[model samples]
Every structure is written in C-alpha cells, then in structure tokens.
Target: MEMVDWNLAVATATRLVRPGPEVSREEARDIVAELRRHAKASEEHVRAFTRMEAANPEDADTPVLVVDRPGWVRANVAGFRELLAPLLGKVEERRASIPGGAVLGAVGGKVTGVEVGMLLSFLASRVLGQYETFAPASRELPGATESGGRLLLVAPNIVHVERELDVDPHDFRMWVCLHEETHRTQFTAVPWLRDHIQMEIQSFLGETEIDPSTLLERLREAAQSLTGAKPEAEEGADAEDEPSGESRGSIVELVQTPAQREILGRLTAVMSLLEGHADYVMDGVGPQVVPSVAEIREKFQKRRATGAGRLDQALRKLLGLDAKLRQYRDGERFVRAVVEEVGMDGFNKVWTSPNTLPTKAEIAKPADWIARVHRKAD
Candidate 1:
C-alpha cells in the first residue's frame, strides 16, 4: 500500500493554499508573458557572467513554466513523490512485516497526506521560483526525450514579493529570473550534478532506520526546539555558541543520527554552494541589467532579516528556512572570497568533479577550499 495518498495531498494543498494578490485577467496574462521573456533574457546574462553553458541541446532547450501557487504545489508534490520513492518502498516493506500493518497504513496514509499538504500549502506562497531536478519525464515538454528538469516561476509569489518590497516590477522580475536562471545553468552546465545529488539523497534515505513508535517523540522534541523551549542541559546556554548538532532548529536536525548528520553536512555544503553562487551571479549581473537592483537587494535583505510575525518566525525555524537564509549569506561570502583570491576560471574548477566540491568546513573558510583545491600554487 502507498504510504501517502499523493492525490489527496494535492487536493488538500489546493484547498488550503492562500490566494495570491488580486489582479485582472489581462494583468495576469501580461505578467506571465513578461516573466517568460525575462527568463529567456536572464539565461544569456547568466551564461555570460558564469561562462557556464548547457552541456547538450536538450539542456539548452529546457522548459520554463510560469505557474500559480497551486500549480507550484502540484509540481513539488510530484517531485517529492519521485525523490521519496526509494524510502517509501523501504517503508512499505517494513510495514508488510508487521501485523495489522495494512490497516495501519490505510489510515495513516490519509493523515500523512494531510500533513504533507499542509506543509506544501505553507511553502507554496513563500517560494518565488525553483529548478526542479527530480521532475519526471512524463512532465517534460513535447519532443523532449528525457527529463532535464524544468524551471518554474511561481507567478503570483513573484508578483506578491515585488509589490510588497515596493521595487520596480520589471527590474524585480528580471532580478528574480537572474537568480533562478543561474540554478538552471548550474544543473544543465554540469552534466553530473543532478545524478550526483540524487545518488547522495538516495544513499542517505536508504540508510534511514526510523522506529515507528519513537517517531512522535522525536517530533515532539523538534517542536519544542522550534518553540524556544530548551532542554535542561541547554538552559542558560547561548544558542549561537552551541555545537553543530546540538542546535536543533528543525525536525530535520533533531531526527538525524550521527551518520545522517555527516551526510546532511555534505548536502548542506552543496546547497550552500548552489544558493550562494546564484546570489553571487545575480549581484554580478545586476548593476548592468537590473536598474533598481540596489534598492531591491536592500529592501529584500531587510525583509529577510525582519521576517513576518512570531508564528511565521517559528514556522520558518521549524521548516529550516532560517538555515536556508544563512546558506545564502555564508555561501555568497565563500564564493566572493574565492573569486577574489582566484578568478572565476579558478572557481570553475569546483565543477570539474564531486571530489573538488567544498566540504562543510570549507564553505565557511574559503581559504581552506583554495588551499586544498589549488595547493599547487602554494
């Protein structure tokens, strides 16, 4: 039996997702058309700035879809299904071994579906755009044989953010497209990246050995951490000074074993690199391309720092978005430092192979990556 009612998850998300800002049908069409044009235009700027080109014709022609909040949620649900298949299959095997497992799964699936839907509904509005690496071939554009993945610009969210920030709509849209197009360039330029990340995720999930009984307890602890309730040992301690694994802001951190933590570190480093590089490229390409880039960046940074309300703050921590924000800051610093020390050509060596990728420590200390990767110069 399926562990999650995927169809139900979609329905629930569609029902719960908040409506985007009101706009006339004509205005919406204009926004969508402009976004598609900007996506294509940003590709050239990204390629020129990063000097990373698509590896093949298919990659070069990767599709860009302009979607609303519900469409974005649906696409992500599909991606989650594809990415979690291995782990779900494993869970199903374990469930089969237990008595009354079939009935338990039948009831649990709907509950899990609802939970997943709620999570997606929360995220659907926050995301601006994404390059979906695990997109299935069935969703590929016509005449495309294999899935090179597709870029999705969440139209409503993009419009919402630009309006909220009070920036030039045209400039803001192109700026957002610049960042997202950099991601498309990253995956398409590096032929091995998508598979490498997929393998790493599969390896991590393949090793998961969760006890069904203890799952609730772990979740409780994670919730406590997000709510600022400290354990006895951590009481009166500075949260900033806490060791890596001890600072549990999210359930992702709370449930991980030591081995899983190690894997997570590797994944974190990779994500930091990707996010940071995108920031770096966007800024690098901004001044010439985006006329109001300065104003947008300043306002966006302030918005990120201030965040929304208490409930939103707690939810951001619970979802590990706080850490994601850190990734952009930390990763951008690493990229900027590396590029300053060695030109973009030298930094490009990082894409040569998986072995050359920065470790978690190196992401914080650019000199370390430089020393390790460019030791011959020393």
Candidate 2:
C-alpha cells in the first residue's frame, strides 16, 4: 500500500492547467472588486429568496474568494485530494495484499492524481463560480482558513464566457454571482446540508473502485473515442448531442451494488433538489436586478448545447458532463412542479430532512413527491 502524494497531485494539476490570459495587477484588482460588489448584492438577493423559498434564514460572513481559472484548479485539486484520500488509502490497503499489487499501488496514486488534475483543469475553465462547502482540509490552509463553506467565484472564466457569448458582461457577472450566492445560502442556512452532502460523497467513494484495470480501460476508450472517426450522424452534431460514451463508464450508471444503488439514489435525489432549487432561485430572483438575466440564461444554455470540436465533445461526453446537463434540467423541472403544486412553503419540506427528499422516480413524477410529502402531514 503505497501512499499517494497528494501534494504531487496538486502540483500535477497546476502544471497541466497552467494559467489563462495574464491579468495585470490593475486588472486583477478590478476583477476582484467587481465580483465583490456583485457578491454583496447577490447575497442580499439570494438570502431573501432562500428565506422565502425554503423558510430558512441564514447569512454567510466569509468573504467571497475571487480567483482565476488556475486558482480554481488548485483549490479543487486540494479539495478532491482530501476528499478522495480515504478511498485511496483503502485501495492501497487492498492492493498490498494482492500479488504484484504493491508495485502498481505505488504508482497508481500518482496516475490517478494526474488524471484528476487533468479533469479539474478542464472543469476550471468552464465553472464560473462554486460554493465549496466540502473541503474541511482546505479550511486549515492559510488562505483557505476562512474559505470553508464560502462562495468562490472564478472571475476570469466568468469574464471569458461573457466575452465569448457577447453578452452584457456586468449583467452576466452578477448573474453568475447570484447563482453561487443561492448555493451559499442553501448550505449556510441548512447547516446539516454540508455534512449530509459530504457524507454521501464519502459513502459513494467508499463504494468506488480505484483499480488500475478500470482506469486503464477508461483511458483506452477515451483514446479510441478521440482518434475514432465521427459517424455521419455526428459529423455536424450540435454540442448538445447526447453523450456517446458507454453507460458502464458513467458513474451515474455504475451503481450496480445494492448498497451503492441505495446511496446513489439518495445522493441523486438530494442533488436534484439542491440544483433545482438553486436554478429556480437564480432565475426567479427577478430581472429588474439583472436587466440581461433572461438573455444571459438563454445564451448560456445555448452555449452548452452547442458542441465544440470532436476531441472536445468526446472529452465532455466521457466526463459525464452530459449527464450533468440533464441533472440541471430535470432538477429544475422537479422544483418548478413541486412549487407550483404545493407552494413554496410546502416545497420547503424537502429541506427538513433526508426522509422528505424526492426519489429518482419522484423527480420524474413530481406529483408523487407532492402526494407523499403532503400525505404524511395529513
């Protein structure tokens, strides 16, 4: 059981991600200042909405962390490393007992780390901001001490996307902040939420396989997909094309074990609820505050739907981001339906406890959830 050097993992990810367009000191300062300004406004708006939506009132005192793409990669790398360490350790322990497994185990962590770094780098380029509530280890670090359970806005990526979409940059930036702030309020107001989500993640990781064969197979398939010719149907396929990767490779589809399935089902339900609620809040926060909110949402969604190059599309499909897009849509629908039927306060029952969350089936059939949640009270 060779120990994985988490430091090496972060270093590898940092190197691969590198830094995006260089921001001058003045530019950096301005970016931070603008995000901070929006952060405050977003907090106020989101906090008010969250209270109305969930019947929970709360506030986050921690200042937002405005960073660049590279900075995001670094922070995520650290977070992921800490979160996955226990599972990696367990893998190492199992491998040590197997013949010839020790040698592979020694290098396995490094390889996994590299893979993680690569993935995070890709995501960092796309994610505008995140409310990171899962990294307790990150909180111990100097700069991250006060960052736990706080909002993190990637200033550069937000700017880059706004420019690419040719939308109102200020409006777009504030919109992004609004979304993140909604998440911040969700976790802050529901103190148990952070722990619950973290626990689900840990349980899922406990069931995950850190086997070399599994990773190797995925890498080989990725290579093949990258090098393979596109089918005629896919030649001009839009970016919103359905994912082409095999379902077996998808984490969402890999819940075969009974325990894993149970945990996954719960996790999925919680994720759908949270994501849907955030989407609803972000959009429902009113356009008077963000004049271009509608335009921003339309363009942003279109951007996701538009496929990039073959290699890029393949990478996205392999990463299961396609499933994530569905999560957003499905979750949004669930929240909207439940609210329409039961009203905001009734929908708030979901936040009361794990028992009240909608199941996967319930997410698809919002009426079932409404009936169950309401029936119990009756």
Candidate 3:
C-alpha cells in the first residue's frame, strides 16, 4: 500500500473492518497493536532524526521536533511537490528552502519531517529577533480529548486525494503538502503573527464575560447526555474516557464583554485572511500540479458537513471560548477577491507585516484595500 493507505490504516485504530462476521476481541486487539506499531515507529523516527540533525542540521541550530506520524507534514509536502515538482521541477536543496516545508511519514524517516524543518526555519527568524516561540498545536481528532497546552497537530490529513478527480495520487499528495507549507510560510514570514493571535484571543477572553451559573448547567447536561453517566459515577474516568476534561467546568460558554467583542472582531478577520489566502494559493496552484485538489476539497468539505459538525462546534466553543463566527465561506471569498484583483505579490504586500496587513475594516470590505494599495503605490 502507499502513503495514503498507511494514513487510513492508522486512523482506523480502534475501528475494526468487520466484513462477513463480527470481529473477535482478539482481532481487534491485534489491529490496535498494529496501530501502536506506527506510533512506536514514529517515535523512533523522531529520535533518529534528532541525532542526525545534531550531527549535520539546518542552519537554525534550534532543536528539531521529529515525529513519524505528522499528518500535516505529509499532506503539505505532497501538495508542494505536486505544484513545484512538475513546474519548477524537483531539487532537494530548493525543496528544503520552501519556507515551511514538512515531509510526511511514508516518504520520510521522521514524523512530519518538515515540522522539524519549520521549527528550524522559525528558530532562525527568532535568532534575528523575529519572534519568541512557534506555537505547535495538535490536530482536532474526534472523540480524542485534549489535556496538553496545545493539541498535537499530528492527526491532520495525510491520505491525499488527486488534485483533479482524474489525476494520480502522487500529485494529489504533493499539492496538499504545498498548501499547508504555504500557511506555515505566511506565519513564519510575519514574525508577530503568533503574538498577534494570542493577544487577540487574550483580549477577547479578558473582556468577554461568561455567566458562570448557566454555563455550568449546560455542561452538566452535555456530559450526562453523551456518557449516560456522570463524572462521579465513573471510576478512573480519565483513562476510561477521552481527554476532553473540563479545565473550567461549565457550558454554553460565558458571554463576551463588550471589550472582548472588539478583539474578537479583529481576531476573526486575521484568521479569515490567513485561511482564505491559503485556500486561494493552494486552489490556484492545484490545476498547475496536483490532479486531485478538487477531489480532496470536495470530499473534505462533505465529511466536515456530515460527521465533523460536532468537532466544528467543540472547536469553536473551546478556542473562541466566546465569540463564534460561522461565515468562513464568505471570508474566503473576500480574501480571494483581493488576490484576484492583484496577485500573490500584491496580496503579500498587505501581509508584509501586521501593520501592513488588512485591518478589520479592510477585511470586512476588501475593496477598501484597493484605495489603500493605490495610495501606497502612488
């Protein structure tokens, strides 16, 4: 099997593919063991990578975070390869230089090899007083709870579909890899991005207030419904259940203060711009490289629509903890218009730095940027 097969296999960790008859407990155990092997291998890969890098590493000299199962790394690398491989052609040196390049598990010896690469990249920037630290978070996995500072961004998609429905898997994967790296690059390029995001979130949370009484009741109800049991009823609930324990016990989320609303509006604009710009670049480059971008985008959206709905809600509630804006499609369209009117170079200028990037007004009305850009150019 290929890389995508491995991806699908790992994801089906607990789920048994029972065909003719019910799967026996032993069979399920074996399947779980197989999945664990991937994790183990990933761990080993990371160790080996660290050693290798220590010997002859990237310029940053920062610690490399190697893993064997970085789904994001794999997907992004495949995407980039799809686009650059055919057009500019493959050159290992140049590929390494791709701002936020990451290698997926199957083709690599380490987990999301490019993750380490990206760390190295940002580390270099940091040395030059670019920023403080890079925030590496986890991917949102269903049923999987988060306890750590950030969710391990390991569960992102690796099984790439063709860029076009008619193309082969290789290009499809490459295109996705490139797409992710594109976002990484944007973040790395804008040093204050990490702080900016955190600041916005903090500001939102600080001002936005929650009703402690109502929130607690809603959460209790949710827990009761999902488990058919309460926390006190279960023995060692942490091990028995997923890790989505309540850091602050409650639900419905507290209401945001007026001051919080101000920050939230700004934060939303920033995220939209980033996400939308990524989609624009990735989608634009799809036809030029991968044949499966359309397929991946279509299936992914469909899946998000059907089953991933809960995750969508859970994420908004947890992260936003307050405000929730559900018009991502509209946001993406607005960003796309800006790019279409000018080009990557022009759009990038807007992101030359936080000061240059679009403010809430510009994002709300991208056409407003037209005047700004013209004024600057003139």
On TM-score, the leading prediction is 1
- Sort order, TM-score high to low: 1, 2, 3
Q: Which of candidates 1 and 2 reaches a greater TM-score?
A: 1
Question: Order of all candidates by lDDT, from best down to worst?
Answer: 1, 2, 3
TM-score of each: 0.96, 0.85, 0.47
Per-residue lDDT tens digits for candidate 2, residues 32-99, read 89989998888778867656332233235654788777677666766676687788778777777889
Compared with the true structure, what per-residue lDDT tens digits does model 1 show for residues 1-378? Answer: 699998889899999999999999999999999999999999999999999988876778788889998888888888899889989988888898999999999898999899899889989989999998685755332212344588899999999999999999999999999999999999989888989899888877876766786777877887687678977987788756767633477867776777887888899999999999999999999999999899999999999887678888888878888889989999999999999999999999999999999999999999999999999953
Candidate 3 whole-model C-alpha lDDT, 0 to 1: 0.42
Query: Model 3 shows how many backbone clashes?
Result: 40
Which pairs clash (backbone N, Cα, C closer than 3 Å) in model 2?
A: 239-306, 239-307, 240-305
User: lDDT of candidate 2?
Assistant: 0.72
**lDDT, candidate 2, at 356:** 82
Error (Å) of candidate 1 at residue 179 is 0.2
Q: Highest lDDT among the candidates is held by which one?
A: 1
Residue ranges of candidate 1 with Cα displaced over 4 Å = 139-147, 226-234
Full-model lDDT for every candidate:
0.88, 0.72, 0.42
RMSD of each: 1.8, 4.4, 18.8
Number of backbone collisions per candidate, in order? Answer: 0, 3, 40
